[model samples]
Target: MTEKKLKVDLSVPFPTEREAQIACGTLSVDSEPKRGGVKKELVVKGNVLNIHFEALEARMMRVGMNSFFDHLNLVIETMEKFGPPEK
Candidate 1:
């Protein structure tokens, strides 16, 4: 049996490039658990954060996306609570 391949791409924009970069850095720190045919990538472009995910199956893709969103939410909250000092 052949596994179905899935791909997901998401982009999130922040008020400032600094915040976007911070979120990207935090999200990139840990990689997905060793799961075959699962891949994730995070990047920052100006004030936008980009995420790409690939999985061998729909279930795996959903789990991976959920995990990413959970962490991404934390990153956003952290930036909101303790962002750079107002200049």
Candidate 2:
């Protein structure tokens, strides 16, 4: 029997489109591991960062989300400390 997938959608709003794009680009660089059984997609829509996650099991989903959030928190903190990058 085929296993059902668990999915999650997350939307994070930034002060500017530039910041959203930066976060998307930065986070997208680290793709999910092949054996992790998790898939992640990141996109920027205006000032919002959209994240979609899918996993074969709840444990996989939770672990993937926790790792992503840790990276996300660091990204937000860095943006807050250094401000936007120069064009």
Q: Which of the numbered candidates is closest to the native, going by highest TM-score?
A: 2
Per-residue error at 57 for model 1, in Å?
A: 0.6
* Cα-based lDDT for every prediction: 0.85, 0.95
Which candidate should be chosen as best, given lDDT against the real structure? Answer: 2
**Native-referenced Cα lDDT, model 2:** 0.95
What digit string (tens of lDDT, one per residue) describes model 1 on residues 1-87? 976678888999999888888888888998888854579988889999999998988888888888889998998887778866353
lDDT by residue (tens digit), candidate 2, 20-73: 999999999989998999999998999999999999989999999999999999
Off by over 4 Å in 2: none
Each candidate structure's TM-score, on Cα atoms with residue i matched to residue i, is 0.86, 0.95
